[model samples]
Target chain A: MRDRLRNVLAGVLEVRPEEICADMSAEDVAGWDSLRQLEVMLALELEYGVRIPADAMLELQSVPAIEEFLTEHGAG
Target chain B: MSRLPTAEEIAGRRRQGLELTRVERPEATALHVLATFNLDLLPPFLTEAFDRVGRSVRPRAGAFGQLTQEILDPASRLYAEPPDEVLIVPAAEDLLEPLFSRPPSQLGPDEAEALVEERLAELRGLVETVLERLPAASCYVVALGATEGPHPHVLDPLAPERRQVELDRFMRGVRELRSLGPRTVVIDWDWHMRSFGWDAVRDERLWYLGRMRLNPTGCAALAELVARHAAAYRGQARKVLALDLDGTVWGGIVGEAGLGGIEVGEDGVGLAFQDFQRELVKLQETGVLLVVCSKNNPADALEVFERHAGMVLRREHLAAERINWQDKATNLRDLAVELNLGLDSFVFLDDNPIERTWISQACPEVLVPELPDDAAERPAFLRAASWFERIEATAADRGRSASYREQRERRQFERTSTSFEDFLSSLEQEAIIDPVHEGSLSRAAQLCQRTNQFNLTTRRHTVAELESMSSDPDHDLFTLTVRDRFGDNGITGIAILRYAGELAEIETLLMSCRILGRKLEDAFLAFLARRAADRGASVLEGTFVRTAKNAQVETFYPDHGFERAEDGVYRLTLTQGAVESPASIMVTVPANA
Candidate 1:
């Protein structure tokens, strides 16, 4: 699961997957924004073929939150 | 896939792409657009069209002896700096003489024919020159000439038979040259005729002088013609034709005409209705979708189309038909909903002054041709409309009319279904999406530039600008080409993903007008959401910059689940699990899009 998240973040954030971590937050990341957040969502869903509910979008606050949500939602 | 080609190669594929996106950039690349003119009968507005497209024109002196020499000799000294996108618009003062009773003898049969041949040869040479310089620059040749009029003196030497001979020969020459490799487009003016016989050229001075006397119908025709060619060359026609019935399709009202009294048949005023129907039917054949908004009993109108012998357009022909006795504005709104067409694609034609005025006031996006009060003038009136000016029509257009008809029938079947979701499920719409690659890049950039409504952050990019984005390591341009069970909608939507360090931004999001309302956009956003979440990116940011035509998408993010952030921005967090594309929407993202 951690490796999968890193691969997705690697492409979206234009960083090596090794550079991404579960502790990453908007303030900690240099380029994170609402726009990039959507890109991350799309890439992850496309990569995993998972369905993201519209209501759950509001609950996503940080990488840890995304990790927990993805695990719960069966997104790899 | 191999690394994307350099920006220069993408711009090299098509020149206009670069021009559109690089307009404000300080560094200007030179483009050579061949604008040929008769120099003998040029219109004052020809230059304006060229100017509108941002081309610097150098008028080549046509084959008029000293005039040609005069333009060529001092030309270098007259303006030292050669302009970018030099155009050669072939216009002449000769065409105007026919408008006047006094005809110029200089354009004798032999001279005119010889000049025609000479110009044909020149055009061929220009094509060769432009092709040789291709990759570095591109040129477009616009062919426009005068038509025969009523003035007999002018008509005497420039007889229709003789002019037809020259025109045929010139056209032959054009075909031969086109075979050799020129990207050529012809604007035929031979069809423009005065009401009177061919000798009407003799009456040019007495009747219509100074003005082209181009009526609404004629303007629409010319615009439609130009638009067709523009689409063919530029790659697609983004405009949609929205229509109205009742007084428009028939004389009197459908509510009042009582089906049989509509007056569309073999006799007197019936001929007017007949002619109008025939012309519109022909337009439908050219790939223009016919949509109807009528205030009538839906069953009665359907019966007319299904039962009437004189009815040329059946109910099956329309992309969308709104037949409720409600305000036309309301019907127009419903029609947009039914077809997923934007208001801008709609060109409404209504004969009734009141209804026409109402629609014009209520839905300003629709182009309503003002018909003359005399029903007798309807034929001439339609001849002058600009709704049909198109630069080119591909094979796809030929099937458009038929496809829309089939689409309507399918919708009707769905109407009886239990729920909208059930209807969507039954139709089997699917969307196939792929990363933006070389094959689809040209078309994708066009959607970004032309699509006006339903656009968020209406960022118009040129092929050049898009190419630059692809080259710059921080930016990613992804295009979505959509097709469904109905027909191929071509490359309809574009998403520009720009990144700064770890964060990504949607710099541009736009969809073609025809593909709206099907939840393809929701699917697109969902795709974006999932992609964003994967990158460990917490929030996906976007903006809705307003334009007069793009209010339809002002609250697009909110409806699609994004929350409004500070200033005009919207944000969505990726932890939002499993975003599903709108419920049971039938969209097919092309597997190879």
Candidate 2:
């Protein structure tokens, strides 16, 4: 699940999947702006068939938060 | 056509498109996109859409919520580097906020009408500004559709308070912009939303998260719609639809089922075929030529058209047919030869997978679409297909099938004549040559783009470019219309001449294949030479730039008393007098010329 979330984030951020760590947040990444954050939320929703709520979109900026949210939504 | 890509695939394609743009490619079409809402998700889907039609577009997104500013301001990025095409997408909620934010009951009828009028006028101004600034760009504007709020009088059929009435009025007003100029194409956003369903087009989560109105799925669909229009604008739209009979059109094989036993009537699956044929007839009316390319006995197929009770397509509706046991690929090639059209302009519809595969391999230029497995789905499939999409259908387009039928009769007339000179005189051809006017601008531009075989220099000029040239004092644009005893072939030729001191150069000279062998080219050249001599030019020049298909016209200039001075340039001295028109045809030139 962590690797899958890392891959989705890497695709959206246009970085290497190996370089994406679970502890990395939007602030830590160089290219993860607000627009890239929205892309990350969309990619995660499409990949897991899960609708990340509008309010939770901004909160799931880190790879760990996205993994936890996906698991809670039964996508893990 | 394949199914619409999923959101994941769209994202991946967007990345691929971005990577492709990093490496420079020559002759790539520049496309500038401006919208009212966030269009960050559109570039990737748009890239894939243009790529599907074998065109590479470099799309640059304008600032969000700056649709009007980008067009109104001259120094905007849109004008910094002019684009070959412009796509302007304005949302109803953003453009018409007063109508949506306030309930209909709060405003009077006059007030509502006045508000809608004001917004439409502003939109027209913006579109006209774009058309004026970019004389070579083709502008595509999306009409306003339904707003996102609820309606109090939604259930009422004739309620004035219903927002749909106002939206409908706005859409109609937007459609009128097509007449503003030939290059402006107004896309039916309302029809697209209704066809795609409102839920798929609008995402509430995205609306709140960002200002984005459309989700990834909706973005992909809209991109495809724009791409289809782009294809039509580039003169790449399909012209002929080759159909198969038997299990493809009707329920069973006519050879075995007999006319009476066939399942094409007013009930069950038979009605499905009937409905599908009705849709095809609509397509025919829009100027797409319908031809039969079936592998059956000629008698059995002709009998179906003669005696079938439920047949919607009659014998006269078909422009041509190849009802034989020959292979479809060979039959298509024969049809291309008969119709004087390229094989790339054909769309083959057949139910047999083997035949489709065979044609796809043998004649790769022909577009063979996959029909649905179920017969009931075929009508909807035809409606959804965008192979014959046109921005506006001209009068000549509506009467194309009839003209082709007349062409067949003319061929028969030619075979019976004693000699070539006798045939030319017996046909009684009349040619009317005139300067390009407002009424004939679209067809004139169309001739410039679609004519290939007889073109001297193949320059595909846009309507906007031609419109500007017609008003310039240095250029003369002429269009020719030919009429014979058979029928009137409308606006079949175009020629553009640019003057400089003592020299007048033929920038573009092309005639439709319908009137190629008729010696009308000589008469048309004569008219041009006279016009150039009257304008005080001493030398009339023409060039033959070689294309794969235009080789037949290689020696055309030298045959008509032009001396070859350079590799492709030919010069004819006006002091030697213009070439004479053939006595068999009566030619009429403009009085002013």
Candidate 3:
């Protein structure tokens, strides 16, 4: 599950999965801007078959937050 | 037509497209995008869509909600360094904020009507400004969609007071802007939304997060539409739709099942085939020449068009037919020759995977779309294919199939004649040469793009470029219209000549392949040489740039009393009088020319 989440994040951010650390957020990545953050949320919904609420879309900017949210929604 | 790409796939393509744009490809087309909302997510998808069609594009979006500023200001990024193409997307929610922010019940009928009119006028002004500022760019304006506004009653008829009705009025007004100019094309965003489903296209999460109205799926769909339009603008639109007979057009094999046993009536799967045939007929009406390339007995196939009660397509509907036992690729090539079109303009449809694969390998230029597995999905599949899209159909386009039938009659006349010169004289061909006018601009530009075999320098100039060239003093643009004993072939030839102090250079000279062997090219060139000499020129020069398809005309200049000079250039001195036109053709020139 961790590997899959990293792959999804890396795909949207246009980075290597090996470079995607759990602590990395939008600011830490080179191409991860606010527009890419929306793409990240949308990709998570499609990859995990889970719906992240609108308010939580902005909060899940870091890789760790996305994994935690996915686990809480039973997608893990 | 297969399946909409998933979010993960779209993400991967977007990344790939971004990486592709970072490289310096000199052949890439530049595209500028302007929208009413945050359209930052569109460039990558648009780049991928254009890439899928074998075209690379560099897309840059303007600041959000700056459509008006970009159009009005001459120093804006859109006008500073103009792009090859422009895409303008306007949403009803952003354009009509006052009406949407309030309830439909609160707004009066007169107030809503006035507001809608004012907004549409503003949009028209912006589009006109863009068209004037970027005369050489192909602009695509997306019509307003009913993405916002309160839901009305299920069975309520549209009224001016209703917000939904007002939005519909706005969309229709936008569609009429297609008449503003030849280069302006209005995309029906409402139709795309209804076809793709409203729920699947819009994402509330993205809207709240970054004010983006469309999700990745919607973005991909829009990108596909714009890319198809761009390809059509570049003259990549297909002209011929070639189909196979048996299990492809109808159900079952005609050789084994016979006419009575074939499934093509108004019942179950049979109805599907009938509907599919109807779609093909629609395509035929739109000037796409339909031809049969089936591997069956000619008599057997002819009987289906003559006697089948369920057949929607008749023998007259087909511009040409190749019902032989030959290979599919060979049949398509023969059809291209018979129709006087390049193989790149042919789109082949066949249900058999083996035949499709064969044609794909043999003739790489032919577009062979994969038909759906289910028979019922065939009609929808044809509707979704964008290879036959055109921005606007000219008069010549609408009369193409009928003109091809006339060409068939001319071929029969040629067979019975004793000699080539005798055939040319008996045809009584009359060539009318004139400067490019308003009515003939589209067809002239089309000939410049689509004419490959007989063209000397294959330069594909757009209508806007041709218009500007026609107004220039030192350049002369001429179109040749041919009328033989059989029929009027419309404007089938074009020539562009550049004049200097003492030299007249033939910049472009091309004729439609239908009029190739008729000595029309000789008459056209003779007329141009005389015109150049009359304009106080001492020498006439032409260059023959070799292409794969134009090898037959490598020595055309030399055959017409021209001496070969250095660098593949042919020179003829006007002091000795221009080369005389063939006596077989009666040529007429405009008084001004």
Candidate 4:
């Protein structure tokens, strides 16, 4: 689950895999704009094989929020 | 009839005209323009932009305000904008369905629902108005229906099903306008306006839209559609999507990344690249050639295709490839040459800016789409690009993906062998050529429009032309469907045989270039010769008129069993029997005309 989150974060930020961290939040990443936020949500859904409802995707702000939601939705 | 004039032809026409403004050209002798929209529905600026084109007018706007019990006769307005007097007539909206049956003050939620019903009713009226006001030989454009707001009101009625009822209703209105005749060309207004933004349409090219409104891309598409409709309406171009390895196909340069380092696995940015490649592979179902061109060594690229289980695009999927460090422009030229295609027929993609710019400067005819600066944008960018635009693909088109795959196998076979004739003979290539009947008319017409390289005379026809000809009782249409030892090449070639007095003339002879190397042309002419013999005709005639792209088959007549006649024409005598229907081939009856 951590690995998949890292991949989505890398794709959204257009950064190397090494640049991503587990503690990252929207403010922590330089590339996390509103457009990139939508992109990350889409990528996360595709990666984890889960349909994160539009509302849940909006509520997800930090890496921990995404991880907990993925657990709840059977993504992980 | 030949297929529509391409973008190049439109540009050529623009050059011939006296440039009144960058937008309007009046010098060309046959200058006519028509606009079809409720003028009141359009923002005023769009109408002004359209004024740049010669003699633009709309009937709906002038008549719209007066569509009440109070006003019986609608007014007309004229504007002198681009030195040409534009006559605008206000047609009575007897057809205009009222948006609100009751006063606006009396409207409730239910009233709003009723208002939508009334609007749809108005659309039917608009369709009737379109039929009455459509001008002769003038271009017509229609705006897509506007959604009332960001909310999904119209779609909600159809709901969960995504039934597209409102869309279909709008299309029905457009169809009624089209059924009126030649001058009506309906634009995909809804799709265009949403995608390109509305303001962009108003500011862009306007002449193509008739009097309707569209976004810039929609407007350009409208102009292209008009030009195509006016010239020859061929189905859309079947694309050969040539991809690049290293930087282009993946996130990083493959040559530098090595096999394991390359981005194409379950993790990292590779997943995005993998997803993109997989989508491209799916496009082969629609007959797009997935060819590979990269500066990496062929062996290294082959390693990715073979050993890498994670690789989405396999080696067999590519029809042709150029992996040498040769200039990509030159490599693309070689690929086209080997395949007997014009550079314009290709759409090249590479991630490296230097290589892309080189192709742009050198092979300017090829469409090199601008990739987004970021890696994540690759998928969305390609989805938006017009790389795949076929209107519809037949069974043959579906087989194209496999045919190209076999071509790669055939090329590998060629490398280890010596004699070209021996390779040709070993494949057991068989062609089934038959007279085009009502069942095969649509595919035959599509072939004439799409096939360029091996076409003897590039004549294009529409659905109407074939229908008219079938009814005429004077013409013969012949289609060829080939299946070799490898697989079925479904309707790869078509020839329209027209009976002129006692002579049979070949109006159009075209074959998909995928089956070019096989001796199918010989079999085709021989079959025609036998048909001529059976008919008691002495002379079988054909012509090899040259086009910019069809130079490959310029000597096609003389090379086969035909003699040169006066001025690029060819003739053959089939009084004697010709080659028997090649034993291995089977000609099946086409399912639909």
Please name the candidate that would achieve the greatest lDDT relative to the true structure.
2
B535-554: candidate 2 lDDT, tens digit per residue: 99999999998998998899
lDDT at position B586, candidate 3: 99
Q: State each model's TM-score restricted to chain B.
A: 0.60, 0.95, 0.94, 0.68
For model 2, the local distance difference test gives 0.86
Q: Is candidate 3 or candidate 4 better by lDDT?
A: 3
> Tens digit of lDDT per residue, candidate 4, span B1-593?
11223434332332222122224434332322323332322322223223333223222233323333112222323111121111211221112222213332454444445444565455445434433332222224443454332234446654422223433554455445544333234545445446545454442222222233442233344444333333323455536777888766676755787888777876767787877787777776677777788888888888888888678877766778888988888888888876656677688887778778888899897888876666667766766554465434567668776776676677788676578767676667766665665456557777776777888888866544654555555566677877766667777787777776678788778888877766777777777776655555677889987887788888877776678866667888766554444443443433332
DockQ of 3: 0.78
> What's the distance in Å from true for residue B168, model 2?
2.6
Least accurate stretch of 10 residues (summed lDDT) in model 2 chain B? Answer: B144-153
Lowest summed lDDT window (length 10), candidate 4 chain A: A34-43
- For model 1, residues B1-593, the per-residue Cα lDDT tens digits are 01122323322222333233335634533322222222221221223223333332332223332323322443532123333222333432232232223323646556656766777776666555544433222234433344433343444554643355555566556545535422344544333332322342222321122122232223223333333343344433434565566666767665676777787777788777778787777777776778787777888778778876777666655776777878889888887766666676677877678888898899997777787777677776765654564444434456666655655666677679898677666656666566666555556655675677878887766443565466566666676665565666555678877666556578888886656666788888887776666544667888899997889998888876778866868877666654577766543443432
User: lDDT, candidate 2, residue B363?
Assistant: 93
Q: B450 in model 4: Cα distance from truth in Å?
A: 4.3
lDDT of 2 at B531: 90
- Note the DockQ of each predicted structure: 0.00, 0.62, 0.78, 0.01
**Candidate 4, superposed: residue stretches over 4 Å from native:** A1-76, B1-96, B99-143, B149-186, B196-238, B265-271, B306-311, B408-430, B434-442, B460-467, B532-537, B547-568, B578-593
Task: Write one digit per residue (lDDT tens) for candidate 1, span A1-76.
Answer: 3787788776665566777877887677776665455446645665677766544444464789888888888777
Candidate 3, B344-436: lDDT as tens digits? 999999999999999999999899899987999998888888888777787788878888999999989999999999999999999999999
**TM-score of candidate 1 against the unseen true structure:** 0.55
